[model samples]
Target chain A: MCGIVGLLVKTPALKARLGELMVPMLIGMTERGPDSAGLAVFTEPLATDERKISLYSGLTEEGADFNWLGLGHELKAHLGIEARMAVQGNHAVLTIGIAPEPVKRWIKEHHPRLHILSTGRAIDLYKDIGTPTEVAERYDFKHLTGTHLVGHTRMATESAVTPDRAHPFTAGEDFCLVHNGSLSNPYGVRRMLEPRGIKFETDNDTEAACRFLEWRLREGDDLETALQKGFAELDGFYTFLMGTTDKLALIRDPFACKPAVVAENDEYVAIASEFRSLAHLPDIKNAKVFEPAPEEMYVWTA
Target chain B: MDSLKFDLAEIPLRTVNTFLHQEAPGQGVRKVLITNPDGAHNIAVGLDFPVEIEIVGHAGYYAGGMNKQASITVTGSAGTGVAENMMSGRVHVKGFASNGAGASAHGGLLVIEGDAGLRCGISLKGGDIVVGGSVGSFSAFMAQAGRMVICGDAGDALGDSLYEAVLYVKGSIKSLGADARIEPMAEADLATVKALLAAAGPAFDQYAPQDFKRVASARSLYHWNADANQEY
Candidate 1:
């Protein structure tokens, strides 16, 4: 039972303050998923204009010094990523849907540890396994600034513990997902998706939903349409939160068995796995907190 | 015992938790009067003391779960799994109780003034539950070793696949399960109910002894399997 939390704003105001708000909510739910924690922030004012770029890099295991900012500059010099940004962590991110699969192939072929967190400017997300506080400290996330963000604290049950196995899984451009329940029919769905040139990096069931939603979105379905299709096709007890660069969506499985609460005010909208998470916010004292309806998808667009 | 009266409407009940790790020393036998506690769940959930917590209104699930020695009494109805897995002490509900009232209880006593719902003592190992009114079906579904006394009517399959628990129903049973059977009310059983009621306070005198019947697990499922026709 991994705990996930996220916020989507109609306007991007607070940068590091958003991660600060999400970090406590993630830590409060340590009992649910004590493994690891990670968060991704999407900020405004990109350096490029044509295509979006997402990068994932970690310094510890790589024996690399503080040259990540320079690496972003170097990658832009060669492959020409339109908008370049790096989410601070021990893992590398990728920008998919670029002109050349060979560039993505070349990056992974050279550095096997860094996987694609997200591609295109559609979404920027991050997730890993560990305590929320520890992960926040490890990534120096207090300095991070963004308008939209999502996070996960993992309690491994079905899959082994690894960075790649953590959430929020990136399937394609502008498509990122986070989940909170067990998917009963993961194998059945995986078998169907894998044959269609869709690749998988982890065995977690949540990645199935991520991949499915991404495939539909790329096929020209809107976010809500893809999510409704996800609710209908998926079977299990789940209450998940997903985001794009412009919108935030909350989804519950058919039965609504897992715990979830949503609070909306004029300033921002927030979703968490428990009431305690939302109750801690000062402005949200009178916030109307309620569970998502069965097989329901509650989406908010910025 | 010093009485501390709280209307609960004045206090932010969500932040008031009597956790084991957060207890102040030498609190003594404090009597708390929680008035107008409308559906506050998990009130004093894991209290590990001898304080008496009297809630004057209705409560939701697991009001006094994992209780060690404190005595908690609710003036109104209780939701499912009330006093669930209580280790010791007493929980008395003045009104009816919901399903799984004392499910998986190891010790202590639960007295319900009115009827109790299904699976009342589903996995009761020890302790004693005395219901003044009727009980729903599957009252003692998987009871291990406990005492359940229902003064009013009991529903179907009263003690299905029970272990060593003793069930006493004062009224008629709709139908018995595989190994549960009605037995005569002996001197020892009557005294046990009388003493347990005395401890639960003033709500237990409504039912007469003659209206009740005693039922205990046959212990057949403990060592013998009927289908296998073998003894372990």
Candidate 2:
């Protein structure tokens, strides 16, 4: 079992409070998944020519102090460009005024152990092996601001309770996904994507789904069309909450064995695995709360 | 009736559920009022006595599952499996409900004032479910017995693999399942529909028994044939 929560603000006035609003929603799901937690915040976009890359160094060697600041300076020297790095526990968000491909290649060649979480103009991802509150505090989550956010608290069912195995798996540029239930055919799906040259970082089923979605989008299928095709290809009991650069989408399997609830109003669109995660939202009593129909994809765009 | 109150926000869900489990059927307390439920799951489960429970706010999954001889009311919407596997008594939802509203229930009455999600009354053994609004697809899949009444439209593939259960739909049916077909209502069916509608409350008083279409199993596929086995 896992807990998934997402929020998309319609009113720009509430943008600054996005992290504050999401913290409680994430913590409320601590019971669902106490082993690990993660969140992805889509903040204001960078300059059109700039890019941001979020990376994680999962569990450094014991007694070895990983020098994140020194790595930033080395990256600057290696790429011959200025890079600003913000370290949050083992995760780091590096903003560079350069293209992404060359930076990614540099990291791949120099720091082969670092795991790239996501790369985009607006997205900054953070995750760790701890309680939701602990992870949030490690990242100073409540102070972060964004226009929208998606998070997950994961219990180890198929994979180890490592930071990289935590949820909010990202594959496509600025795209991430969190799943609530297990997948029955992830190995088959991985076999399919592997032949197409899609690299996988984790054996987690949600990562397979993320990579599949990235491949679908690469094939020119829109979010709704990709999800509709997912229903036909992916076989399992699942509730998926996915986000793109500008949109948030939700879909449940045909059986809908997993639970999900959506609450929307003029100010925001909020989704959680249960109503308790949403009860504390602003004006929740007045919001239109409903369970999404099975196999039907619902999306909200910024 | 002697009434007891629980504010879920102040008390843990385990505490309230434990209190209900220990309370005797004919004991001093005859009614329970749970305020600020806020959609906590598995509330008031496994009750075996005739008591009235009124949840003042939204409730989560399996609100009254495996109940017996009790009357439960949710003033707001209910989550999935609201009255699953109930043996007796009545469960009423003032607002909408999620999937499997009365799943695998044996004997009871479940009334939903608003729309119900997918697979409402799935695998129903003997319970009677009445929905005031529309129900999603596969409303009564593999139902063995009892009756289901829907005042609004039904989504795609209603009553798939249905058995002896009787379904009465007042609105349009998107499609019927395999071995399921519409049949004419008998006099006894008309009486049953009217009684169920009346039990649903005054809002359903305007629906005449004649406006509904009855659906039942064909009974021809009870035994498997080699030719039909290809379809499986």
Candidate 3:
């Protein structure tokens, strides 16, 4: 088993406090997984094209439009500067770099199924295997500044011990995901996505789900609709943590074999594999902490 | 002498782990009440002070490893390697202990209230160990010193290659090792066994001083004779 943690805050200052705040929680969970650790922080009101993009839903595999023409190079030419882009949950995150309002407006106009979850600065990323302390020291996470953060500690069962196999995984410019537990039906999902020219680096089932969600969101499906529809297709135990720049989402499998704890307050929202990790944080007392109900999708706003 | 109560579901395991610094400074005798009926692992590890630990349910592996001066009492069946590598202090299992109980023990007393799995007193050096129930195979495979008294039947190969340790089994023996042989339970031996039993706690009341048999090594493995009938 591995440990996963995500926190969403309303203020940018909380983003700056994230690294230091998450370090102790991560340290407390070292025994669950002694392998690699990774974190991704997101800022809202991103400057890239939020409308002309489709989130990469990992549900539908084949016949999805991944046509690069007039998508990548054309957008750069239309816009003055380079756009910050990431792929997550079948949606392409296009930060216009300079102006986020126009890009957010453009995304809302073109893709009705997709909406801007967050409007500030959004960061989507993935990292490799190690203890939480090792990762924090190596990455200097104690000094990083952001508004939203997602982290994962991996225990390799299906995938090989490589950096590529670690989470949080990125699909395009806008989407990222982290997962706990094994998926029994990854091969079936892989068969659907491989034909669409989407290649997977690791044998882990979480990546397969990521690819499927990416494909669906690109086709104009809302995050909740796509996730609700995709939930039935997935088999076995899984508790997923996903996010865009503006919002954080959590999903638990039907069986609830895996564990996910949530602690929420007016200032911040935190999700972790164990209550001890969340309780270890400073100034986190008197918060309402509880385990998430099984097979439910919970989304939080920054 | 402060007492702490740990309830089952409300208990956080990390809280217990963070506080277990028996070798650290300023730690003293404490009374812990385990209100949880469920089993947990690493209940008391690396303890050096004389604290009283009372567990109400079954315990998992290495119940008391590297123990010093504390006394641990378990009221249920113990998992594997109970009291393993015990340096000092005492560990009393009110019920059975799984395999390799008291393996490589250095000092202190290990009293088992019920049966013991294989290799009960393997590699025992010092300390007094008394088992109220039957012992599995290879009870004292390489005992160097100390004393082991089993009030119940002992399994096969009781003392394979023992040194100077004294073993007393009150019940039937399947086999004896290289130099191990049965000896008459003398008055001094009975007195020692009775004292050990009395100290073993409430579960050891039915033990009788007369119904026991004593087994000890004849000091043969220490010196090997080249021309003797022994096979090297």
On DockQ, the leading prediction is 2
Q: lDDT tens string, model 3, A1-302?
A: 88788888766677678778877766755776678777677754433434223233222242124433334564567545465565432334455545455554554464333423333335734364567787777556676566778888888777776556777776644577888888899999999889988877568788888878767777777778768866978887788888776678889875455667677887789888765567555455456554565556798877
DockQ of 2: 0.67
Candidate 3 overall Cα lDDT vs. reference? Answer: 0.71
Q: Which ten residues in a row have the lowest lDDT in candidate 2 chain B?
A: B223-232
Clashing pairs in 2: none
Task: Flag regions of model 2 displaced more than 4 Å.
Answer: A62-64, B24-27, B226-232
- How well is each residue in A99-186 modelled by candidate 2, as lDDT tens digits? 8989998888877878788899988998888999999998888887888889999987988888889988998678899999999999
Count clashing pairs, candidate 3: 53
For all candidates, state DockQ relative to the true structure: 0.06, 0.67, 0.02
lDDT of 2 by residue, B20-121 (tens): 778545566789999989888998888887789999978988999998988999988899899999999999999899999999989999999999999999
TM-score-sorted candidate list, best first: 2, 1, 3
Candidate lDDT values, in order: 0.72, 0.89, 0.71
Clashes of 2: 0
- CAPRI band for model 2: medium
| Candidate with the greatest TM-score versus the true structure | 2
